[model samples]
Target: MTDQKFDIIVYGASSFVGQIMTRYMHEQFADESISWAIAGRSKSKLETLSKDIGLSDIEILVADASDESALKMMCERGKVVISTVGPYALYGDTLVKVCAESGTHYCDLTGEPQWIRKMQDRYESVAQKTGALIVHCCGFDSIPSDLGVHFLQQHALKKFGQTCSQINMRVAKLKGGASGGTIASIINMVKEAAGDAELRRQLKDPYSLCPPDHSFSARQRDVKMAYDEEYDSWIAPFVMAAINTRVVHRSNAMTGNNYGTDFLYEEAMVTGKDGRGKRMARATAWGMNAFMVGLAIPPVRWLLENHILPKPGEGPSEKEQLEGEYDLRFFGKTSAGDKIKCRVTGDRDPGYGSTAKMLAQAAACLAQDVPEGAVGGFWTPASILGDKLIERLREHAGLTFDLE
Candidate 1:
């Protein structure tokens, strides 16, 4: 691995989020500081992205998602590979396989739990043996949630002598627009769940991604719409909670159940404390439910894919991305009745701008911070990257994880 030519490779560099990440990397890292490159199936697209981002000197590696030999060759040359190509169930298998077999560290912006489970089942052993540190959900869907829990729990342990037994993450403010790539992943997940009863069941399980031998059987709570006196707000179901909660649980499990086997976690968006807030909560819940149901139906799904949602490579403009932001509040309680509060905020759009930065920092952390011969297998952002990544995010990714 020391002989690898590049420290990091940005796979799918010409994709929507990929392009954003490339620009970020160009601005953040000096040539002497890190050896990284851009990669995708299209040489022309990669070249254009490099030119557009003013990354004139960055190397470009071309490899299609399905080409095993090319992917293997690409994987073997990079210590860490950051994948922006997603709807991962469809296009991410080969790259992950190659990386796992070649002992390359990997991270991605995928939020697809089912696809993550598939990859874990198929490649976990190989990765473990080869010492490939594969981490997922390095993007908006779960990073803030997962690492927010971690940040709070660490403070809880230090202040109260124990971890939080229950934690609730409330999105107080989230302003962002989704790209076609994000919507496509959601649609593919729904389409899979609609056809597979087992998948639907797994999707509902909060610990679906935990190790098979784990003993977590706690019944997790789901908020449809409710008034919370604690925060003085009306809460609605969070669309990303399904995957985020699972990632958090898996992180707990992977960390030797540091959060306790019976730890409870939930995520929701907070509406204001008023009649209008309650109405908004109900509407948000209803809208989310309707969207999922519509996606399950073939005709409605087609309509959404073809006419409603953004297409691949289409997303919010640079202005919207730069102006967007999120404020996530975490309220935690230890078993001894001690309380802790914290918040995680980002200065850019959650889906594209913030996600791109978070993913880049995660990959860089994997490349530069994680020491060689660390226990390796599938990992969540918080479980593997932990404080190292939190530091990077605060310093360079325009994110704040602070106690309130």
Candidate 2:
């Protein structure tokens, strides 16, 4: 809207997830008419990606997220900025500020609750005043989880004559690998756990993901999530813990709590193989909890921080995450026998594959084609775009959210 030089500008397009976003952009707009460019801190890596990804004709721009002037210049050139750089707490805030200050809408594939929440507090007011809609968690941690629940709530109102008070999402069947960037994110999270006790605790509160009084539709129920034996399948506790569920709730809150005051939410991964898989998943979760707790310890935290996770300047290879995939199922039910369920299946892995599509479309849609008057400022993919993003996903990416 500001007469920017480009419709959209992608930041960190040379990083692990960023490269995938760049490729998606190539395939999606190969012959289309879209004024866009790839940008990163390194012109060489950007050029190499351009050659490797077969986008030699496309121009590559250089802008380090840490460099304020360069970042603001990039933001000034695009109606929206799509960011793929992450462990966002470390390298993201500066761009977010620039986008907000420049009135350039922003979006990213971030599942890090601590960082998302921090941005809301530090930039929400500025974003609101400047008309920048800063959206995070556009990927697996909550896109499907967030958008899927929005579908359930809408479906409930239309058919059940009542909104669901509780909804449960589980991993039905999935196979995938992690990107080095994803690995780097996990390692950094572990290291952060070692340093900040409050962050680990804040991530537990479902309402903590958004700005205060934002009214997220659901809340984290303090109950042991387990498999449903009656379904004859194993369902382990949710992997995202409060991250995904809280985001969905935040969407609900941001949308005026349209679902209801007493909405409930939880999510999990699927397990089977005579329930052995479920047991193993539970065991794995137990280990993860222990590891997170261990990371919080003084001596253990120091060792993990220094030896395990890569330092800020390092991360995973782009090739690895692009090869991964993630699938999920969300089952919603009413107080009676009424029931409805949906599945989120992605062609790419959740961390990278699915995220690439989600992030690219997020910026493109926000800039080029999204319907007008969708509430601006900090938002969830569903809360702002609602069916708008779902349609984009189906048309632009091999993503599916089907009801059964």
Candidate 3:
């Protein structure tokens, strides 16, 4: 491992988020203190990315998502690989396979739970033996939620001597445009669930990403549209809750239920208080339901894909990415009736701008911060990276986790 040529390799470096991340890496590590490179299926695209970013000295590696030999070669050279190429269910399996077999650490921005579960089921054992620390949902989908919960719990223990029995996260504000890759992943998930009853059922479980032997059977709350007394606002389902909650639960399970077996967690978007809030909440719920229903139908899905959604390489412009931001609030309560509140805020777009930095920091953390002999397998960001990642996010990723 010490002989690895680079500390990290940014796989799929030609993708939308990957490009943003590459620029960020150049800005953050221009000193070349941390050895890194950019990689993708297209040598020309990778070269273009390097040129466009004015990163002439950065190395570029070419490897298609499904080309096992090229992927293996790429995996063998880096201690950690950051994958930004996604609809991960379609193009992510081979990279995970190669990384696990070669003992390379990995991180990605995938919010697809089904694909994550499949990877865990198939590669956990191999990664454990080889010491490959594969972590998913390192981006906007779950990092704020997973690490937000983790930050709150640490405070709870310090202040009250007991972890929270339950925690609720509400998105107070979010401003971002979705990328085509994100939409494609959602559509693919719905497409698969439309035909598979088992996958549909699994998607609904908050513990779907947790280990199969875990004893967690808590019936998690599902917010459709409801008035909340805590924040005094109407709340609606969070689009990322399905994957985020599962990742948080997996963190707890992996840490021996450090959050407690009866722990409860849920996430939603706050729609404000009173009449207007209720209307907004109802509208949000309806809109989400309608969107999912449309994606499930072949004709409607095709229409949305071809006409309504951004294409894979398209995303917010530079100004938009710089202007985008999010504010997330977390409320936690212990069994002893002690309560705590905190907020996690990002300085850029949740989906792309902020996510790109988060993913890059996660990969850097895996490569440079994780202690040697750390047990490796499938791990949630908070479960494995924990405080180290939180620090990295605050220091370099434009994310702030603060107690209120």
Candidate 4:
């Protein structure tokens, strides 16, 4: 084991979300002997952040995410790095390369599936060889979705002696806000990859989530049944459902492909609106769905590129993002009358605040606690870290993973 200077390094520490994570770390480990520092391209931004968060106790390093040499140097200084760089396709792959090459474990809060697929193909072998555990979706998009499946399946195994045959994650209700940074990242990814057919294909390919052998069809299970009598209501599409479900599938793929053996998995929204309002919401979902589907076409894609999306460096206010919250409830069933219900709740805003905390805890676990000789490579949040991350989130992040 390397006697690294810091247990964990928060890369991109100058960004809005990165600043939150850095402050959390400073608060989390104010007096620990384990060393840590902040790294980013702008020393001034980092200095400003340090002052804002009163992190005079922690060291700060200047390292650009785009600078390969700087990233490697940063990776060398810490056992693990939690990167908050957005869209990741543009600024992330380089950092992954550096960390994988240097044998430092890495974690990120990225939701760009295509970018993630690209990194897996390019770095899987190298990461395996270097013993770098490059884990992704350590945020709202996938954490609860993946771990929710894990927790439910574990219970199913314990109760019925069989894995959950089907899992349905429903966002019963949500009251939250989003960040400009989060919005910027999403638009950045769309603008960056919308031009490349191959990249877009990689993003949409379900099997491409991991290796071919890791593929599992989430739609195989029947999801059209009426909602449970308790929360009986019509469901609609979750804005982030696409990203979250894919993460769960990837999680199952990483864990020997057994979580959903012969199981179908999906996520949906529990539209709080009912009656006429629910009908309108459903119609709106149809329109949104139509729009998303149309974006797949070349001409429509072109229009979105030219007309939509904010330019680079423009994203959400810290206050708005920090105030957001998310609630996820899942339903699981087996053929043998075994039923399970699980929920994952996050307190901080989904796009920025909660995501930052989720990522920080994930990286900190890998840095300060993950056992040596454990499997290392590209993995989803749940598959790579398992209960360790769940526990830490509860203890440190105020995030809850409850099974009932």
Model 1 C-alpha lDDT versus the unseen true structure: 0.92
Q: Candidate 1 residues 142-227, lDDT tens each? A: 89999999999999999999999999999999998876887889999998888799999988888899999988888899989998
Q: Residue-wise lDDT of candidate 4 within 82-132, one digit each (tens)?
A: 888776877788999888888898988887777787788888888888899
TM-score of 1: 0.98
Give the lDDT of residue 44 in candidate 1.
98
lDDT of 4 at 339: 85
Please give the CA lDDT of all the candidate structures.
0.92, 0.74, 0.92, 0.75
Error of 1 at 131 (Å): 0.3
The 10 consecutive residues of candidate 1 with the worst lDDT sum are 1-10
Q: Look at candidate 4 and give me any clashing residue pairs.
A: 177-324, 180-315, 180-316, 181-316, 324-349
Clashing pairs in 2: 179-321, 180-316, 215-253, 216-249, 216-253, 217-253, 324-349, 325-349
What is the overall TM-score of model 3 with all chains considered together?
0.98
Model 2, 7-74: lDDT tens digits are 77888888777877788888888776577888889999998998998886676778887999999878
For each candidate in turn, the TM-score is 0.98, 0.89, 0.98, 0.88
Stretches of candidate 4 exceeding 4 Å from the true structure: 1-4, 192-195, 215-231, 290-323
Q: Which regions of candidate 2 are displaced past 4 Å?
A: 1-4, 186-200, 214-219, 222-225, 273-275, 298-324, 335-337
Candidate 3 structure quality by residue, lDDT tens digits, 1-404: 43558999999988889989999999999888789989998999888888888987787788999999999988878999999988999999999999999999999999999999999999999999999999999999889999999999999999999999999999999998877788889989999899899999998888899899999987899989998899999999999998998999999999999999989999999998989999999999999999999998899999999998887778999998999999999999999999999999999999899999999999989988897679879998998899999999999999999999
lDDT of residue 122 for candidate 1: 97
